[model samples]
Target: MEEGRSSKGGVKKEYKGGITPFVVGVSIVAATGGLVFGYDNGIAGGVTSMDPFLRKFFRATYRKMHQEEARSSAYCKFNSQILTTFTSSLYIAGLIASMVASPLTRLYGRKPSILVGGLSVLVGAAINGGALNVGMLIAGRIMLGIGIGFADQAVPLYLSEMAPKQIRGALNMGFQLFVSVGGLSASLTNYGTDKIQNWGWRLSLALAAVPAGILTLGSLWLPETPNSLMETQGPEKARAMLQRIRGTLDVEEELSDMMEATKTSEMVKHPLYNMLQRKYRPQLVMAVAIPMFQQLTGINAIVFYAPVLFRTIGFQTNASLMSAVILGVVGLAATVVSMIAVDRYGRRLLFLQGGLQMFVCQVIVAIILATKFDSSGDGSISKGYAYLLLVMICIYVVGFAWSWGPLGWLVPSEIFSLEVRSIGQSIVVAVNLLFTFAIAQGFLAMLCHFKYGIFLFFAGWVFLMTLFVYLFLPETKNIGIEEMNSVWTEHWFWKRFVNQEFHIPIGIKTSSNT
Candidate 1:
């Protein structure tokens, strides 16, 4: 394998060749999971805001939305429990389903989990399109949630494993990029279908199946990741695949490291229990904190409720849907910026910069709304201020799309060794979905009570999470996936928790090993 030395004199493996087309194609196909995730996020708000959709299953909410006096309680008009539950149930079910995906991913391989997720989404979309009642709507959403849980849990791991260390961050971010594309697709679909007087929402929900079907079929052709192969199919097949993936015959050094890690992992029957060991404290903390903090950023709250938010601020239904389309477009573009820049500028810089940008935008938006818009008066925001609010929200989306949106999945997927990787990913998915459910369920109520102050509340979280990264997170650029243990052991703080004895046999010529 190619090699390099850190400033501290630790040896590191660096892949030397250019990334092959085979890997790129595989990574793109695997990232369809993000599309499914993005579509749901984008579709929910637009569908809910549609008059026909609201009239059919949420008549009370529809009437409240259309009433003259509804302006008096702008944020409270959409506060129906059933309505929010329709949106939140998928996340809760996803949270549960992710926990179930942990072992299955380890046993059957990443492709299977992705395929199952896609199939579940396919069925869920069909059910949702044909739903006859609220119960059927929720049931369909639950199936969709299960599908997302599985896909979200496995896709990041699959991408991380398959990508060469040189562009792992960029490749992994492809998942988030597709997520943006899916959201954009959903927003565009919602805009077009809103004109269909009676069943526009049905079409919006059904189109989710198109991407899900692609993922399901695409997964059938995916090569099992080398890391997964090593763990489950022995070293010979793992080496063969690694060589094929790398487009090189000189994969012995990397394959040897994979074999060593897999051999150690084989002795651990329960990765969940193993994760609780003191040595894994860093991984454990990150798996919980990263995903939890990602949700706390309040990006999802905006994505999930953008149409409602714009309408609450006095935009027309078509205007609200169109505004969501704007946010999706901006987000998709920003994610492309991240994909191109992440490896060059590094993850920590993006996180810090994006955090500062989002925090500033949120505070400014809150200030503008609090000072200029009279919440107690029965009037919509002025045209200039309405567009201004949309501008600030778009900036906020840019900040998140480039930073937390992708790194939350990338960092967690890369940190864990072969043994705990699957379970570690499960924790990430579960925590992310749990807080996502909480935000979807509570955001409307919080908006009603807190009003503009809700933005300030998220600003506080953004501050704390930024500080957490500045203090605790180590820069992981250029590190091989299997060699991540070195990063923790070298960090000034985390080193105390990492067992000095712990090492991956990657031919590192450290003085101690020598």
Candidate 2:
């Protein structure tokens, strides 16, 4: 086995590169987008819980109703629709921006795309924090969505290109790790400001600006991805960038691989048209499926309706809020674990591991809630059942954070080429938000009507997610971004994943053109 150690698989066996501090630093700066992403995610749900902001912007129904809906059915339905719109506005805007993200990234390059995202969030946070009415809040939500769209689309693409195969999985997940951190920060800030009355939620949301501003300014000094420079600029600039980012003069071999890949990438006569050809169809399907399943896993349903779920399971208002904050902490911890172990353990293993655990967790949660969380005739779930439900939900969050949360972003970026990278990401990420929007808009109704049945729905999705990964997606652990077409187009590719013992023949020719 002159191919080195035949004893192992993935990035470890293929790459012997050491981690560079400069690359790590740049990654940290770019990943601040995840922080803002997470912060906004947590903050939006929590803001409605703050009495002062809710009363002011939402016109005191939250206060008058005592955290419950109005007695009038018509008014309640109208109010619920409006409130749902406010929360989903960001995601709606995200869908709009995602449609155009590919072309924008192509035009501006990844760095500028990220800069636009950061500035958009900065403006959004300012508007929401100072809003006097629901209209202003919705407007701010749109900007936030647009901003996050830019960051989410570009950050993963940038990391996948800049990072070596050895650290690619781990480095790409850095965004997810920081997202958990940002979420945790929002939870803590909410807890800290819980007693500050009306303006507390405003202050909590405004804090998202801090990270946005930091990423926007810090990214100015980051080196553009060599892949991007190679395709758009030229070899000399690409080589210089490789030297700076990798901290090496010995980049000749690496440069050769990228150059060859870039040539193959530009072989396309028409970008979108060529991307839809038979050879590219499989990656396109996977690109769409990964993000869609990530949302369909019902994690957002849990997040958007946490208080209602907690209260339904018998938690007091204070206890429910506290539970959300604790869940945020647990999720952040799990994401950190993913960042450390992703490259070491390989992507598919973690994905399969998480799927198994999440499936089981959902089953248990459904059983517990179904059997134990009966209302006490006063609309409160029994205390014992509430506590039991809490434990199960924590376990559920752990499973998601470790797997889909990080990998959802990482996978799409890896599976596409430079030619369609931006647009491909735009399509998938937009689909992700669309799934998110559907869940956000419909979840409360699901909660009111289905109760424990909602967890069961998630459990069913876990089964499909697990099977999809196992049967369809191959182990792309150490595969270079440029070599992806070869992997997808290999003969008997389905068997490669199924048998696990079969390796592609060394001299086999790729039939991507066929």
Candidate 3:
């Protein structure tokens, strides 16, 4: 039962006992939290474009959508703030919930937070499916948002803590893989349900409960992570759980690391306030920056409005939804690729490559739109060019799904020391949901004004984020969660802010690298 511990040089021996059946099964179950998140993300865009959905809640927007407006105004057809509010409101609620869930997650174990989130989604789905008025709809959305915030805040941390050091990157990526799967499921549901006429949208919205329910029930049987047990229970219980999870009794070394981390965590009177110290500057910066950059990449803007975006670019109603389904498929496949390669190739390389790939795809899409559809041309794009646009969009989705989509959750979850890990993940979810709200709220409006230039706006952001990663982000591949500080301490720029002595107190031989 040899396991890799974080070393300065690199991982010594890979955990031969990593990827146990119990651990993999639990990781898969916990990853369903991402399914709820992705399903909701994919559902909003498709449902918004459904004729029945719009005619019921937003007749004016529906009327505008059907009218023979100017080609330039095509982007503005669905630009109603109130309509976008239905989608964006969830994110605003999620932002608040992520912040509120932080202390609760720390006080309790991660499993309770996940359970609460799932139940909220279940109730919210029921509300949404039965809603007859705008008020009911928004209220339901807020509940869903709360579910997402809590789930998003805790699941990554849960996965990170549960995963073995050698396979941590691959296991953490299970969250994003399920997210892509959930999005694809939503797209396929929307594509099929669109034909059911008046009540189809309800079915689409209601089906969110399936994943939520699974997560809720599955969480009941799941064991708390060894780290959580170490903190809340005791070292012996933590060791026992670790043995069970690892399928081995030779867990003394790993349990010792958890004990040391817990000791440091115990010293902190207030984890949130302690995060503001100079020693934690790098972790705090990453907690904020990574998720912030993830949203700014404009992936969510496209994902949340794919159906509307395709229709705006001249696809018919059915075609737009089908395009979204294709995007989801591509995203799901790319995530699988990421799961395989993240640990092998490392996060830094993928981040740079994915950023570059997305940047190129966006610029190409922008150029195609700029030249193909101008004032002189008819509002409609040529069928050939339309297919090309979809291809480019799919390529862009591939880049994002493989990179920022998963790593955004992964990096923040693994970076912080145990003392601030929960709070750090809360910040990650908060920043993610905040910008997600902004993008969902303003994307259509921005498209109305910036038109093709909006792609350029996102491309600019992609370039900056890629540069940020190249300069600041250290490779966290194969590192134990407790030894994360060593990665920062060895970095060129981050080392100045990281205090090795603070993270590894006197006589703690946690890492030979340090």
Give the top-scoring candidate (TM-score): 1
Top model by lDDT, which number?
Answer: 1
Candidate 1 per-residue lDDT, tens place, 99-206, comes to 999999998899999999999999999999998899999999999999999999999999999999889999999999999999999989999999998998999999
Better of 1 and 2 by TM-score: 1
For every candidate structure, what is the RMSD over all alpha carbons to the true structure, in angstroms? 1.8, 4.5, 2.7
Cα displacement (Å) at residue 314, model 2:
3.1
Q: Return the candidate ranking by TM-score, descending.
A: 1, 3, 2
TM-score, cand. 3 vs. native: 0.96
Model 1 error, position 500 (Å): 0.5
lDDT of 2 at 218: 72
lDDT ranking from best candidate downward:
1, 3, 2
**TM-scores for the candidates:** 0.97, 0.89, 0.96
Model 1: lDDT equals 0.90
Model 3 residue 94 lDDT?
93
lDDT of each: 0.90, 0.75, 0.89
